[model samples]
Target: MNRRTFILGGLGTLGVLAGGGVLFTQRPEFGRLPRGERLARLEASPHYVNGKFQNLVPVQVMNDQNGENRFVAMAKFLFGDKSHLSPKQVMLSKKTDLQTLNPAEDVVVWLGHSSFFMQLGGYRILIDPVFSPYASPLFFINKAFPGSNVYTAEEMPKIDVLAISHDHWDHLDYPTIMALKPKVKQIVCPLGVGEYFESWGFAREKLHEEDWETEIKLADDLSVHVLPSQHFSGRFLTPNPTLWCGFAFVTPQRKVYYTGDGGYGEHFKAIGQKFGGFDMMLGENGQYNMAWHAIHMLPEETAQAAEDAGAKQLLPAHGGKFALSRHPWQEPYRELTKASRDKNYKLVTPEIGQLAYIDGQKNEQFGPWWENME
Candidate 1:
């Protein structure tokens, strides 16, 4: 084909792909914010600014001094070294049957990469469940590596509380949410997150949308505090219309903290001081790049955050499932294991689906399971 014809054909193909992406985002699974009262509540939040949500401290999404455009940076990351990016063999997991587990046992199980199933204070809580194979509007993008997906929607029992940290596509999965609706008794998410659930036909009463520093009494035995995470939120066309946050699950005796997804910031110290300390802290321990230093934390930073949170033991999540960054999938594990050495908190590295007792086992023996996976 002539150069002119080839260029024309390429442009046409690009147009078609872009159009398909636009339509894909419009699917009901993508979800939308509520208007009227819900919108008013969102606008009233301290984090909500003139038109968008803001982090506790200023965040620089990129630190590009070399004037590299976003498209160029994105392309480089998209096509980075394939050999170190994902495991040749899928990572391993240890199964813990959620349906049969004792709810009174106060155990926590990692469902891979920012997802958790915990029975604390006689309450069953599921956090950021992304059981779907991919973490994108388009199924082909951000596909989970083989063997990473062992638990499915069918294995989950009726959840006492579903704690969603933000509206990110990976975290607020539509297919997973729809599947869990029958089992989710109540959902407590950041301000503006309920709109998405309400759009999906979740009862307005069941949706407890909270702003930063606000306390939510999920039950007589459980109280959840919505706290700040230096992160942004959105799913489809719009961005940051919803607030992103961390959480402190307070029971009569124990406090469990979850750093949803965020960069290392002073908010961690502030939260630590506010709550005194966490018995078990779940930190976001993967998907980091210097390009977006203000959003995600590096492994060293993860260790620091654990110390700042005054955690008795730090249980790392946000890894083991998805390779959302350019780094090797197991890099976070290797780095965090080294960084947490002699730190204030014990670094707890349980294999995905293994039992992590929040209140029962404060000193669970952890080893680098991903050592040979790469």
Candidate 2:
């Protein structure tokens, strides 16, 4: 080929690549970064340093144990055995008509993964809601198990408070947030996560973006406390621009906690003491591996964390929906059942969309639903 012709072809290819990059960045799913006053607030936070949020204890997102780097871990997860990574048979679930429920009842409906629909203190609240069929940016990746995604944004009643734990795609879904924006009366998220909501046209007055140890009153009877989690946050290349956290909902009569994706840490005990003791603990109990043990907890740790938090009941989250790890689909349930045998807390395993009472523990019997499934 002539030199002039080769140069022209190379330039054309570069132009196309540049155009594609621009389009990719423009997608609404990418969300918006913190800027202007939001960026200033983040910078002032004690947790925010060197342009990123820091965990209470230093944590490695991917720990290199036994000479295994992140690439080796990824390769094993993608091309390894995976014989039991996904269930061969459809999982079991029960659908509850959320709008038809009595407003005076205090209950929790598991919506799969880290998503939940909870009515506490006579106010409806949603936590880390990912209603989309998949958890990742691409539809084909991290797809939810069959019969697991039974609830959608349309099925949810008007939300009194929408609480987001972080900015990861699984916890803060773009499409789901957009669909539920009209029904959400208020939004509570960790520092800097509100940038995404403001960019999507949610009113700034509705956002209660806060830092760790801060409390926001949602109603006269209910208050939401932003707590700590040993986890990292990021949607794309940059990590920790937004903070990751847990939530403790305190009413006049009861207190409940949600441990948003975190590994074993002493913060659990600290939070437990601060709140006295929780009535129930919604712990992240799946998608864990030794390679990333610094970020995600094993099933045994999930139980121990609840114990440290002085919880009487523990409901597992971050599983029963998408397969994001290499373990068997039902391993978390089996392991947690064994782990909770000697612990002080009772293990609560409810099917997707099934109601689990948060108030006095009536109708708390949930069978091992993950069993008998392929």
Instruction: Count the clashes in each prediction.
Output: 0, 0
What is candidate 2's lDDT per residue for 39-76, written digit by digit as tens? 99999999998989999998888878679888998888
Q: What is the lDDT of residue 121 in candidate 2?
A: 77
Clashing pairs in 1: none
Clash pairs, model 2 backbone: none
- Residue 166 lDDT, candidate 2, scale 0-100: 94
lDDT of 1 at 269: 91
Give the clash count for model 1: 0
lDDT of 2 at 216: 98
Candidate 1 local lDDT, 226-303, one digit each (tens): 999999988865779898899999999789999999999999999999999899899998999888889999999999
Worst 10 residues of 1 by lDDT: 358-367
